[model samples]
Target: MHETLEIRLTVNERSEAVRIEPRETLADVLRERLSLTGTKVSCDAQVCGACTVLVDDLAMSGCTFLAADADGRSVRTVEGLARDGRLSPVQQAFIDHAAFQCGFCTPGMLMAATAILEEHPRPSRDQVVHGLEGNLCRCTGYEPIIEAVLAAADAGTVDEGVAGW
Candidate 1:
């Protein structure tokens, strides 16, 4: 039998205690065990940023990140981007700016953008570009995505009371 570890973690604001193998990746636990499939796994090497998720409000690649490391930490997925049925400002900005196609990279891109906004609420255009460099969009939809991020910043949507994210 594979040695397992019992870990307590908060995901999407819900608390859960789960048994997992030490070798398992956060993406595997989130997708397989927690049924949070919004965090897509691609390139599995932490290069594509497709499996990006937030651990303690910091963006990380779930695919390569160990699940055990997330113990006692807060994990946020793309699904958490909506609150009370309203999309987070970054997600809404993605739609308003038509920043997604094929929808593969959107989740990672959104999480990354959320991290950016959390750090720099009013980042410049170049800053947005640099922040998203780790994420790869196979749909080649960068312009609108960039515009959406910029618009979200311009609208000043990342205040504490405004977004529970």
Candidate 2:
């Protein structure tokens, strides 16, 4: 029988305490336990970036990250991108630019873009490309995504209303 470990963490600005198996990944805890399914799981080896989530404001692969490792940390999933009822700048930019096709990679892409904007508020085209290189999208051909990020930056919405977590 596997032992369950008690962990306390913050998700989407809400505090949570959960009993999870030590071997459980952050993706499993977020999706199955916490009911936050916005974090997708693809290429579980962390190569696809489909499971990207923000831990302490940095992009991390949820599928490869242990839930226990999230104890005392703040995790932000795609579902948390919007606050109140307004869409985040990145989300809006993606929509305005038609950055996604199948939408399977949208969540990770959004998180990655958010992280990039946070790190480099005015990232150049090459910087945006480099920042999002970890995420793989079969649709949109990457141009729309880059454009969306740039748009978000240009609109000055990338950092607006976003907490420092």
Give a tens-digit lDDT track for model 2, residues 114-141. 9998898888999999999999999889
Error of 2 at 88 (Å): 0.6
lDDT of 1: 0.91
**Clash count, one per candidate:** 0, 0
lDDT of each: 0.91, 0.91
TM-score of 1: 0.95
Error of 1 at 98 (Å): 0.9
Q: In model 1, which range of ten residues has the least summed lDDT?
A: 156-165
lDDT tens string, model 1, 94-113?
Answer: 99988998999999999999
The C-alpha stretches of model 2 lying farther than 4 A from their native spots are 157-165
Error of 2 at 5 (Å): 0.8
Clashing pairs in 1: none
